[model samples]
Target: MSEFDVVGIGLNATDTLIIVPHFPSYAGKGPFTHEILSPGGQVASAMVTCAKLGLRTKYIGTVGDDERGRIQIESLQGSGINLDHVQQRKGCQNQSAYIIIDQSTGERTVFWQRPDCLRLDPSEIDESMIKSSRLLHIDGHDTPAMEKAARIAREHGIPVTVDVDTIYKGFERVLPYVDYLIASSEFPIQWTHQSDPLKALELIQEEYGIHCAAMTLGAHGTLARVAGKFHYSPAFVVNCVDTTGAGDVFHGGFCYGVLAGWEIQQVLDFSNAMAALNCTAIGARGGIADKEKALALMARADRRVMDEIQRRL
Candidate 1:
């Protein structure tokens, strides 16, 4: 049996969350309530969410040997995730982000930086580390390393799930190994130059022959194409406090559904619920509701669909 249910190789970030009354206009200033330094990242937060949902998770990545790095390590340790393979680069500052969240609308503006010195080299990827997990999750940062990991996982017949928000240079090399790809709403359209999102998704899947191609529409939920079928799941209504880690949580939930062998529609719905619940709190991982809570919210929460997206589908 594998040592972990899910193994992730990707990015981790330490965030300083700034709470402001509202977002300011360009060259405009606004009084901020306060800021709290927190730990959050693409694949890192998803692994944390998976661990919280009772999945045996493992995270492999690199962080700077700084105070922020220490904070990230402690948080992962507390989250019950295995981090034996995480690299701590000397004389480097961890990846960090400053998120300015508007309290009135729960919207956020993020400014982030990741030093090149903290980059994970492809040579550091070990076959043993990846082979010990049932599922593999990765982000597009450290593109070469991610490609290496995903390829190794694919070679082993392991399903690779990618959480990408933007186009990365040479990302084409990574997509062939990816079985499940859930990306930001802008990624597909941007990747294919096919203004129509659905068509873009189709193009990507056709180009790579991936099993599933999907994108997350923040407040509009998620849409996926699997087995040549399009599945749309609407965003659930909630008292959204921060939309910071909503997408990461959705990835986590979708991972859980995959591990549980859920139907496509069920996976979409469960992921939507998880994302909605995460938005109810301040920090990135603040509002990750338990299974019972998510199910209850799924049962009672109202969903809003994007009319344009619906019409497109």
Candidate 2:
């Protein structure tokens, strides 16, 4: 048996969230309502979600010795995730984001920076750590490090899952080892340049032979290709407070469903519910609902369906 249910190797960030009455237009100014500092990163927050769902989760990455890094470490420690391999770099600033949130729509605009000093080196990836988990979750940052981890996971027969939003150089090297890929909506078009999302997913899957290739369509829910068939799950309707970290939580839910042995449709539906619940609060992790709450929302909430997306299927 594996020592952990999921092991995440990737980014972790501390964000300063500034809430404004509305998004400022060109040359426009506005009064801000609130300011907050929160801990969130792709794989970090996803590992938090997995821990919240009662899974044994571990996180491997680098952090700075700065205050923001301390906050991130505290957040992960409080979440009950293992951090045995988290490296701390002296004199390096932690990855951070300044998120300008529009109160009217819960939409956000972000400016983030991650110093190269915090980059995770491929040598930092422990093969034994990769072998300890039943599943490996990674993000696109530090492509070479992720590629090494993914390759290790593949060699050990541990399933590899990825949450990628940006197109990184050398990302193709990591794809072949990925078993499940759930990317940001734009990544498909950006990677394959197919223009059409459906075709892009098909192309990626065909090339990499990934077991499942999928994309998260924000409010439109998720679209996935499994075994040559496409499955679409509509986003759940909720009074959204903040959209931060919804994708990470969705990926966590998807990992849970896959490990739980649910059908593809059920996995997408459950993931959508988890994401919707996360939107009902502030910050990346503020709205992460427990499994019971997610299931309740799944049972009762109305979904926002996109007819155009359905038509493509």
lDDT of 1 by residue, 72-121 (tens): 99999999999999989999999999999999999898999999998989
lDDT of 1 at 241: 94
In candidate 1 the C-alpha lDDT for residue 237 amounts to 97
| Worst-scoring 10-residue span by lDDT in model 2 | 121-130
Task: Show model 1 residue runs off by greater than 4 Å.
Answer: none
Per-candidate Cα lDDT values, in order, are 0.93, 0.94
Task: Name the runs in model 2 displaced over 4 angstroms.
Answer: none
Tens digits of lDDT, candidate 2, 4-98: 99999999999999999899899989899999999998889999999999999999999989999999999999999999999999999999999
